[model samples]
Target: MNVVKRQIDLKRMFTCTTFADRVRFLIELAVTAPSTHNSQPWRFVITQESCRLWFEPKKQLKEADPSSRDLFISLGCVLENFVVAAQYYGMYKEVRLHMKENFVAEVFLYDRAAAHQEEYRSLCESILKRYNARGLFERTNIHEATLKRIEDIAQKYTEQGVRLQVVQNSTDIKNVAELTAKGIRIARSKPLFRKEFAQWFRTNLSKKQDGIPGYAVGLPLLPSFIAPFLMRYCSLAKVLVRKNTESILTAPAVCVIESDTDSPETWLQVGRLAERVMLECYAHDLATSIYVAAIEMDNMSQELAQTLELRGRPQFLFTCGVPLTNHRKFTPRLSVDLVLK
Candidate 1:
């Protein structure tokens, strides 16, 4: 019944006939797209004929994501939602990237309406509930059937060609753990990485959401320890190196998503595929944490790909497991005003 209500509301927003109504609705949904550190580095240029999204390069994570790798990943996340939301609202939508000095996408939506499908509606519904779960997962092994479902999601729209290697074996898990530890260690050695992490660390004990919130790490006293020591040492790099290594080296399983061409479009597809996988897992009470820290370091990425026997350049390192039955806590999100332009 809730799904039905949401669909009806979405349909009304789409079929309002007023240009302002449609643009407003798209803007509302687009901003909810996931971003690194909730930096929200996107701007929308809306029109009756088309809606374009621009990456606000200034809002980007300059130190950690110097090349805007994760920025594009976040953009891909919102772009997928735009496409899905448009379809759910019975609009025929097409997206094309317009690369100028900065990358922006011109999304063309046909004024005419169509019928929304059950699958499209489902994707739209999942958007609100989707978030990263970084807690220590349950010991239960994922069923083969569930793993196959994830594969199906990965295989869909795969013509754009992203490779998702799901690692379940003990040996494979250990291999990725080693690579993750290595990547985390290397990243810690860089002063820039520590600085970036420090900037995103929130010390506010009162707020429940955003800024790698304490709940995501399941550590209540983290901010106290992190705030003082993160920037104090000349070798802040060494301190981060140990902490990061510890987190990745013990994770249950790691999944690597890669692509033949590491372009913007392909990365966006990876986001869509990942959201699908995450939502599908949510339905079955599973959880995942994305450890980009491990994959961003070149050496760690190469080792992870080799361990997974992947065919393309790796783009994301996703560590997933079933959450302990009582460990689930939905992360807070910024309200509509927080996301919408």
Candidate 2:
């Protein structure tokens, strides 16, 4: 009798509560969306009757994201999950794009029979479980079947114009490696970058409630008072160059997301697509991280774009690391109530 009761509880836990309840559940999953400094810079408004989703730009990261590109992309990540989660709960969402003042999307829902229900639930579940993996992954090679699964997920949005270029060849992968190393060197060398890094670096990782704690960053701080000041003066590039460059470029695969124009809307689209790929990769037991700092350089950006055969500018670079089998627990996040505005 106890076993039967436990099974019933498990089934209920996975069942849909209501349209409003599903939206609430999906927003909680959306908190898993990645940010530049674990900024968690996104908010959502939902009208359950109409099932409309709106993006609110109340929380913005001023220093790191000046143009709000990262924030919008992070919102896209949440929107992506909302779409998938909606389907899992027997609803389909149609996104309406508005582009006069700033790029914002209004999503409306409809009830439709979905052919691939289980797959949608699998992707939605992954959103709840995924995290930005900072640990060194195992040297295991990702299988061809897993690559194909990613491609299958990529084939979904025909409109809004998203192009996914996977780096599969040895030569191309090596070039990305070199470009990423160069990017890391550039990011580390900047005084402002180091200053920003110092601000987010909390000495007491355990006591810290929000922000990127010291432990999650995986870098030891200099003294508490002196680090920020020194970060203001030092060349971060010079510091990273001293480290082993080759070791940093060993991710299993690298993907570049491109857009025809560098508009705010396009960045949002790229963000949505990136969330899709990242969540899908997580479901397949693949670890992932984004590398925007690399494309900050002209030479590195051009080199990576050419490797991917991408015609347009390479807007974002995401390094998909296949875990080496051994896994680490995810970084902690703020409670859902705190994250939602």
Number of the top lDDT candidate:
1
lDDT of 2 by residue, 21-46 (tens): 55555556556677667656555566
Give the TM-score (vs. native) of candidate 1. 0.80
CA lDDT of 214 in candidate 1?
Answer: 47
Please give, for residues 158-227, the per-residue lDDT of candidate 1 as tens digits. Answer: 7868767787777877666666666766666777766776666555363734555544455566564466
Clashes of each: 0, 5
- Residue 341, candidate 2: alpha-carbon lDDT: 40
